[model samples]
Target: MATWQCVKQCGACCHLDPAYRPDLDEYLSPEEMELYLSMVGEGGWCVNFDRTTRECRIYPYRPRFCRVEAEVFEDMYGICPEELNDFAIECCQEQIEGVYGDRSLEMLRFNQAVGYIYKEG
Candidate 1:
């Protein structure tokens, strides 16, 4: 059977400036923002991203954009096919499933409600 994995904690997705996202910060509650802020740092990368290692510190709590499907990644991020791993990256599939396992509906609703859905920038 196949498994899933991400880009080894690559911070590419988190590199975007939250400066343009005051609406983003306001999208969540103060408590949620505080908890999330405790994890973001320089480069607007998630605080979990260790600059030296170029990896996410809090992989487990990473948001949906980080959990993107491989095809969606290439299509949405313009990553070439050769630059990505296969459909399921195997190594951490179980870990991802553990988090998003049976929460498909919840995830969809929450993301939609908060405007976390994708759009071309």
Candidate 2:
């Protein structure tokens, strides 16, 4: 695994996901999703992101998406060939396929079906 460090409370990374994804309810309980929703605000930003003070409201309660490197390592197949293995554990198609088989492929298909990607013309 590669090493990483958070640059204080920049909140820049949080902008990636924007709002508390509704799809989270599928994986997490309704109560947990509610807690996350409580922290979401305008511009789809986490409610914990304070625009005035430029800080986090509940850093302790913040979700794992806020800490992505670790999440990617644990949740995903631990592979991102394009990034030179910076954001996640690097693994070739052969290596990953041996371990994850179709599980990761199913997840990718699900994300694609659920509009996990954004695009514009």
TM-scores, one per candidate: 0.37, 0.42
| Model 2, span 27-87: residue lDDT tens | 4556756666665566666666776775777778666644445444455334444453344
lDDT for position 86 in model 2 = 45
lDDT (10s digit) by residue, model 1, range 1-121: 2222334433444554456345645344566566556656665566666778867776786754456555655654555665554332421232333334424543343334434433468
Instruction: Name the lDDT value of residue 57 in candidate 1.
Output: 70
Error of 1 at 46 (Å): 2.6
**Each model's lDDT:** 0.49, 0.46
Clashing pairs for predicted structure model 2, backbone only: 39-47
Model 2 accuracy (lDDT, Cα) = 0.46
TM-score between model 1 and native: 0.37
Cα RMSD (Å) between model 2 and the true structure?
13.1
lDDT computed for candidate 1: 0.49
Best by lDDT: 1
